[model samples]
Target: MPTITISLVLTFATPPSVGAGGASGTLADKVVARNAHGEFIIPASQVKGKLRHACEQMLRGRVPLCNPPRAEQMCPQIDKDDAGNALPQKDGLPCCVLCQIFGSAGYPSRLRFHDLVVTDADLLPPETLRAMVSLNRRRRVAEAQRLFLIETAPYFNGLQFQNSEAITGQVDQPSHIHIVLAGLQLLFAWGGGTSHGLGWGDVKWEAWLDGQLINKIDSEEVKQICLS
Candidate 1:
């Protein structure tokens, strides 16, 4: 029988993909450039909370389950405090019975039960010579490499992403986030992201990653012009 996979359903009423970096453009230009929907597939590092929590069980080879907040719980309250301030819910609050299980396989309505994987070994391709070496560059992995493989697909929110084109963002947003110059384009000209110097794993890889990422963001101007 299949493992007792856990799941929670929540709807995300997100504004369509905005822009990335500090880019500015028409909304029409933003949508295709940003690929707001595509980013979710290769999500950023933020949604690993529940995954980390359930990881203990997953590591022990048990049926790891996930849970998170309800859609309603995600809503902010309009009521003000004594100082005429709004009573904001604590950040990181669980959205539901499984809210605490952010990475436990909730949100992302596309997820389903069969997507759970109780073991990690199934992800690697027999841990061969080359693959093992490549993964070792990072040496330490808080979680499995195939953290979001299809076997576990439809489990998490299927990957949620924040388009760089959004009007505002976290205080220390990466510089690449809002730039017009693309790393991907640069990598092509500069021998794939780097010229092989400094630090672990050729600077080439680092350069490639940096350039490729910024080239991907959209401009808030696009969302404003098209979406508004």
Candidate 2:
């Protein structure tokens, strides 16, 4: 098994409202996700989902991928026998590249994603609140009594995890490392409100294979992989 250690530095140009469901006695209707220590964090699922989307978009035309978020079109589509019993996967169906890395039903992911956290508590800025209004699509106007307050994490520079707290995961196949890096490079925006200009940020990452730091993969290398 090859282990990959990744350090992700997220620099937010605008405050992000990475919500935690509905309000829980908080001042706003929506609040940012936080850890038990009350430190802001980006969930592993969110990071994985965004990266999967990026990979899918990049490989759409060049490779075959099952349509995700749609069960009927998922990779390694389940088959049935004459009696409607599910057939075993050894029957020749193979998962798409995206599913190989990110996983699908009955298939475990080749790579794992850890929650991205800020290691330095002092770097965290004060949380802020923003008011937004829901729109009436048909009438093209603000819906009456639709005003809501959402809590957002303040903008910060080089917010990252360091040392043991770094974003790390193990990959069953070392060859899949480049694909993961390419997807990371393609990812620019995260969290919610991206269209509204929130959660817009750049990612800086370093990868280590086994226990040794590898030569940094550059944008050119990523481009080649994406095009290949």
Candidate 3:
């Protein structure tokens, strides 16, 4: 199993909402995911979903990736009649590139994401994890029934992929490595509220096999692959 260690500096363009999986808090209505250390973190599942979507968009030639990569997954291209009545997709099959990596309904995902922990070496106070309040627009005021709180992470963090089989077929390892690297740099977003403007980050990738830094991914390499 080959492993890729990735480093990222995340600057939230807007408030992010990576759901905490429950509404157990006494004060805030919702919370962001955190570790036992009380540090804000993004779970591996979130990372996988974002990357899978990016792969589907770039490889499948769709603007936004499909939900389940199925027939119901909204296609960007629209069909219409002479009268301008929209038509549904006639084919009921999913044949996207994500099926090869993340797997389809019955297949298993080839990549594994390790939880990305925020490396806030500044040792800032735990209270820095800001809690924001939201109110309803219809009421013209903040009401208890419509009020909610969202927690946001700090500025910078580190991310990693513990293990992934970049190449499953019988070919040179370098070819398979490039395929996975391109997916990493496909300009993806993480956590929730991305559509609402949040979690904007870029990755500087480094790979290791048997404890050796073999290669670094550059823009030129990615361009060459896209051209090919």
**Candidate with maximal TM-score:** 2
Supply the TM-score for candidate 2: 0.77
lDDT of 1 by residue, 26-64 (tens): 212222121233222212221132233333222222221
Q: How high is the CA lDDT of each candidate model?
A: 0.22, 0.69, 0.48
- Model 1 scores a TM of 0.16
Q: Tens digits of per-residue lDDT for model 3 on 40-145?
A: 6667676666666665555443221334645344232323322443332223433233443455454354555665665543643343244443555797666665
Provide the lDDT at 156 for model 3.
Answer: 36
Better of 1 and 3 by TM-score: 3
Which is the winner by lDDT between candidate 2 and candidate 3?
A: 2
Using lDDT as the measure, the top candidate is 2
Residue 5 of model 3, lDDT score: 40
> What value of lDDT does candidate 3 attain over all alpha carbons?
0.48
**Backbone clash tally (model 3):** 0
TM-score of each: 0.16, 0.77, 0.57
Candidate 3: list runs displaced more than 4 Å.
Answer: 1-16, 26-29, 62-96, 128-147, 154-176, 195-197, 209-228
Off by over 4 Å in 1: 1-42, 45-68, 77-86, 89-169, 172-228
